[model samples]
Target: MKKTCVHLMLLVVVFCLTTIVQNRAFSELDEGLGKSLKQDSVDVWEDFLNTLDRRGLSDPHWELESEDKEKLINYFKAKIAASVSEGLTSLPERLPSYVHRFPEGMLQTLKSHAENVLKVNPHNGAAAKFLAVEAFHKVNTQISSEKYPLLEKAMVLAPNDIEICFFAYAACTRLGDQTREEALVALERMLERLRGGDHKVSYLWTVRLYTSEVAATPVQIYLKINKKHPIIDRWEVVLTEILAVFENELLQTPDSGVFNIIAYIYEAVGDIAAAQAVFKNLKPFYEKRLAENPKDRTALTSLANIHNKLGNTDLAHEYSVKVNPTLAWEGQVLPEFSPVVDLDGKPVSLADYRGELVLLDFWATWCGPCIVEMPNVKAVYEKYRDQGFEIIGISLDTDEAALRKFIKENQLPWRQVFDGKRWEGPLAQQYGVRSIPAQFLIDREGRVISVKARGKRLNALVEAEIGDTID
Candidate 1:
């Protein structure tokens, strides 16, 4: 009775918000290591019975007397009946010592339980994150929640879910803040923070995660750091790839988390066409979803975004008229008028870079391919310095010092910008850069001549028009 009392008390306290995914809709169920063990298995004894099948693994699961098992199950049943969410914070006290027997395997089992039963079963993405917290203590390596596939899926399934997004941010921080990982996590957090007052969250992570996708992180830390610029050819290829990602995501899963990132990627690479496509595709989904559930805040805000994209001033203003409804469809909408930021801590204005050959290049330090063509770009800048070639290199680098040092070392001889804000950087989203080494070639007339072009390679195209080589 004492043991059961302790077990039950622990069960009642810990919980994460959960949702129930319709099982029938999901087709056949998976039962790797007891995750898919039926509801009966949630009870201690039945769970123990299943555990008995592989008694060697019983250390992770309970190995108790029949009576004790019955008591723990009863406690769990009461806890579930009250609310199936208050998940067990930890296994029953005095779990078999041998649990340490298969440390790695046991950790995997707990993770599965967290992902499958806690998160997916009820469709409660929030609850599933708790599983991650538990896994954090169990392992040596810090697991970035952004990189975790489960968190990614949860964000995808529930883009408007704030708690889940917060959980993802926490997870990314736990994962050691690796640039891409930090940016991925930061991207989600940034969108949510930007939308705190109003709106739909962009919900994609890697694209906006600030570690500057276009520029390279220095190989060495200080002034002695080895630096190399990206290969423009690769940038051309990757820019197309990022645009392709945006276009393809819209066509296939329109209004998805990844689509938003692709849109940002497009802008980062200066592929406005591809970026606009994202808003265009999202428009119908938001409108349709709103039509089905006009009360849905996420849907309403998304519709507002479409209006914002189309420059539909009147329609965009109309969505601001909020009326509360019980069941909403998407992200919560706050007040509008959030301005995008440039990396230099300055607000970007479209009117400023007019009448010049503007090359908005987005890159990261970690991108092996992006750094290969920097020399070519440097050459282009030198060749056309007197002529009219303008290169605005926007490093996706989150580290202000490193970004500055990178420019200094490469002797870029161009205006550079970055907020050290990773994926959430204003310019990145304004341009929509998903991958590294993305360059947009803009002509003097202020019209976008090409979405995908290399810094050095496109210069030649421009030179041909002068009727001779720059040399």
Candidate 2:
């Protein structure tokens, strides 16, 4: 009986001790987990701050070494993983706020993180929206395909996000898949959301949506090709709404950018009378500025450009002279330059093309207008090659492969200068070339005949100059 009692006590003690050990193990694990979550959040926030600091200094990710870029991406990836592991539902909502802070090099990693979020929580609308944005950026960079489906999914999930609707509209327009009615619906929704809000933000979004080169070019091309199409009627309606918004905002605050955009929208939709009225309004504001500060170069240049566009040539010339007495206006001698090398490592220069009527062409492969005008340029080149006509193509293409492919495919015979820097190229800055498809018509004596000739005007100018030599 004594042995039985001792054995029973030993068994009870062993059971109690085992239970305590297991409980202690679980407590330690819980503490470790909490510490890990805190540490991950700290690390991610630190990385976010570092990223902002780098971007604030204008440090481009492409300039970073591969290892450094990989480290940054890994940081983001680890943060995302930690968020998922912790079951943090707010992460989807928070992650997008950091998207634009990172460079383009982190796009793929971001996309992956978004995908993982969606995998864990299929209803994560914010994650879906971010993925769509990433896809749009990729498309802009020519690195991805259409993301309309992803956008559509995001819209279905988050039906009230007007920003998502705007992006969806942009995606559809870029894909050339949305009809006039569909596009109008998206625009109306965007306008509805924007109504009675901060006018500056509204104006900024309006400019982004309707006035950018990417958004405007296709619409302009379509209207040019199909003047009487039913879509034009719908476009007219949308433009009227957009104008009303701008006019209402202008009534509250007379901003110069808003005024200029109002005129631009009017001109785009073929409303010359309204456009003239808007420009007519601009003169008083500019005159007031000039009266206050006579030598305000910015105001002087704005007037000169606006007048030039309005075909008030004498006023334009007057302002141009005020801005710079020795400006390289038409009928003036172009600034002299030494030789610059061509893409083939051959030394060629504007001086080399002296004694010939040269077309100093500043363009880029990515420029929609430049691409649209290339065939005409090619035809003129082929026809006028035998004459004393020359064309010097100063390409602002950043992609070497794309530039080389375009030149080879088009069989461009002109001498091209390509330094793989878009607007910051040396010659482009020297001549003050701000926009693409810019042309300078230089006579045989290297005198500037026209500084902004383009399209049909360029064709006419070139033909007139080379006509005598042709026959």
Candidate 3:
């Protein structure tokens, strides 16, 4: 009995000791892990808020003045530091609420701020489109060309997002190309939900997207009849709200922002004249801003782009010169594109073959059609070698090594240039090359009479031009 009691006591002591050690170790480990997580959360939160702070959104740009801008700006710094003390899994929900709690004007500004430097990090594969569009709507115009590209990527990344696609619609119209098919798909989804009773903002936008050229009749009818109706006039309320949003910001300022959105809306609604008048007024303002800040390359570039789009070549060229004096335009009388040497550092010019009939063929290594007909090109060149015909081949091969290998293997008996820049030489831009396999059959005088000739027909056609062919 005494031995059994002693053994039982021994077991009880071992169990108590083991339990104590485990609980103490676990407590220490939990404390350490909690500290580590707190540090990580603080770092991420601070980084996220810093991005917004840089854009002047944390304190709100709309309400800034000589009095409180500095204090508010500093507060963004302080608040960002404070936010790091929170948990990560709670951030997404917390962030939206935090934004909502911001001063009325700050929400829009924050949205804009968030867009410029989206949550790009080690894991972010794309810009946050939903965040960007929410911010973009608050601004008067696009800040950069990159925004359009970002919105496009966002639409692809989140195809079901309707609000993101709405901004995408505006971006496609502004930027041109690449998003048409995808944008159409998203618009159809939005259209399925839209009713004429939803309001003019939703319905009119649907009409613009669905109807290639929106008829003026329905818009005129909407304007005349819907001004008094509550649901339909909600669009007017939105316009009013936008005005309020920009009013304080542009108040007593020389910003033609109010007019710009009105014009954009008018243009979107098929009212060309209204859009034109507003755009015309704003154009001068933008141009004047460029004049005031001669070093504002962005402002100058935008003006030049607009002019170029409008077919005002001379004005466009003039403004483009302000941003970059050397970048040549494509559609011009002089050569705008020239081939660089891929290997052997070769250089050929139109002046080199002044007396010879030059068949300047723009070819490429990646161009399948160009490759398929290269043998024929070689045969023609060989036949015309002694006939005062200079077949100067320009390979638009982007890769120097690839071009050289192709040339070496083929044993092409022709002088060629393969320095892979495109549509930027004096001769190329003059000729207006829009497609591959484009050839300029120039006479001995260096005057091109025909272009876009290919295959055996190109050789015969060139020969006929030089009075060398029987036909």
User: Best candidate, TM-score-wise?
Assistant: 2
| Worst 10-residue lDDT window, candidate 3 | 81-90
Model 3, stretches more than 4 Å misplaced? 1-44, 47-249, 252-262, 293-295, 304-342, 351-471
Candidates 2 and 3 compared: the better one by TM-score is 2
Q: TM-score of model 1 relative to the true fold?
A: 0.29
The TM-scores of all predictions, comma-separated, are 0.29, 0.57, 0.33
By TM-score, the candidates rank as: 2, 3, 1
Ranking by lDDT: 2, 3, 1
N/CA/C clash count, model 3: 11
Candidate 1's residue-wise lDDT over 199-266, tens digit each?
22332332332234223211111112122423333434434543443454456555455565666656
Residue 374 in candidate 1, Cα distance off native in Å? 0.7
lDDT of predicted model 3: 0.52
For residues 1-471, write the lDDT of model 3, one tens digit per residue. 999999999999976975675455444433543433223434434444454555335554433333233333233322322222211112232242234324545445544444443443211212354354444443334453545555555555544444455555544444333433333444444443342323444534443432333222222323544344544454444333333333333454545545554555565445667666655666777778777998787667767755664568898878876665323322222342354442467666677777777777877888888888778777777777788776767766667778778888999767776545665544444454545676666666666645545687867865776567553
Model 1 scores a C-alpha lDDT of: 0.50
State the C-alpha lDDT per candidate: 0.50, 0.68, 0.52
